[model samples]
Target: MLIGVFAASLAFQAGSAFAESYQGLLKKGYTVGKMSQGKSGSLGWVLTGKDGKQFCKSKVSLAVVDKKTLVSILASGRMVKVDRATFEAGIGGPDPSLPLLSDLKAGRVGPQHVGACTPLRG
Candidate 1:
């Protein structure tokens, strides 16, 4: 009985640990380059800072659920779902998404707007 309780506790911890990742905090504009498949077979984008300098030379992958693609930071695996307006504007250009990111960080976003985001390993 004690073992079962301990197992449940461990599972819960693991689940909640990844519930929110550090990626969700990034609000700065990133220039996402062309999409390409990484060596690991994950489809991702090459991101860069607004200055046109190299940001993440490696490809960053996004998880899409129910036609909604999740956005996340490459360094951390935190994720958030933005409206179509936000996504279209932010996906490839310099767009201020601080308010949207803030809403996600504060958990003010509704369940319908929340999606899964996982960082790639490579």
Candidate 2:
């Protein structure tokens, strides 16, 4: 019984460490690059940061209500239900007048957006 408990605790600790690693990647600023379509039409996305660094990326089965909204889970297990307007506004371009989503959907990947995430100053 003690051995089982120790193994379980180790598994939990490893899981937590994995989650922290993904969070650390996000804190470094990663942008969504490619979204792969699933067998059921669901989607998966890949996020890349500046200097070609890979951040947290995920694939999820999504249910779309409107043509403009997507509800899915992030790689970190965070539930994200985003609409076109919100997505566009939230992922604004360097000029704020342009949005990265528009370019992404149009097959154009741009530079990483500044201040996109909490700046890591350590």
Candidate 3:
């Protein structure tokens, strides 16, 4: 019984995390711009809002398992939330603990706060 409960907990965690992807962002009216690699080896992305004004730009760390893409914010210098003109300007802050998941094969993204991009500037 203990083993079964542990397995269930793991499954639950996976389900909760396996959400949010490039396609998912598009469906939600977000435009994911080109992905660039910074000198620190982090992936940078500029996702614009539906109206094309506000955006979320941050250096991210990505992990690919099978067809799943797990991305975490590697925010280390001047984070922008949603109020900026240039896409890439600042760079000087501490790292964040936000994680987002995306499934490449199934094209699914998820558990509620998947689209959250707070405390970041454009």
Candidate 4:
């Protein structure tokens, strides 16, 4: 019985119930804020690429997963969850904690950077 209860709890916690919607997260600033690649703000934001070209033109937003974790989303239909502590400490950023690479490699990018640049500018 104890084991069953513990497993149930684990499964529940693994899901997005621990996460919040983009706007819902913006409302609660429990160590979370707006992150944008272009002149940071809550809305009217843009995501730029390393080549200085437009990547994702989105109204990106951020939400706190925990005291040290954050979830970032873009209206362009991309999302990435990152570790706020690491990101702020200059260590930075998750994509469901796993990534799938292809046989043919194009560009080399660290897996930690999943979505556009939502640097938690909030």
Best model per lDDT: 2
List the lowest-lDDT window of 10 residues for candidate 1: 53-62
How much is the lDDT of residue 107 in candidate 3? 22
Error of 3 at 121 (Å): 13
Model 2 C-alpha lDDT per residue in residues 1-71, reported as the tens digit of each score: 99999999999887554433334555667555554433333333344565353332232223333547655
Which of 2 and 3 is the better model by lDDT?
Answer: 2
Please report how far candidate 3 places residue 117 from its true position, in Å.
13
- Candidate 2 lDDT (Cα, 0 to 1): 0.43
What is the lDDT, from 0 to 100, of the residue 72 in candidate 2? 51
The candidates, ranked best first by TM-score, are 2, 3, 1, 4
Ten consecutive residues with minimal summed lDDT in candidate 3? 79-88
Reference-based lDDT, each prediction: 0.40, 0.43, 0.39, 0.39
lDDT (Cα, 0-100) at 22 in candidate 2: 35
lDDT of 3: 0.39
| Backbone clash pairs in model 4 (N, Cα, C under 3 Å; residues 3+ apart or in different chains), count | 4
TM-score of each: 0.24, 0.33, 0.25, 0.24
Local accuracy of candidate 4 as per-residue lDDT tens digits, 72-91: 65554345777777765663
Q: Is candidate 2 or candidate 3 better by TM-score?
A: 2
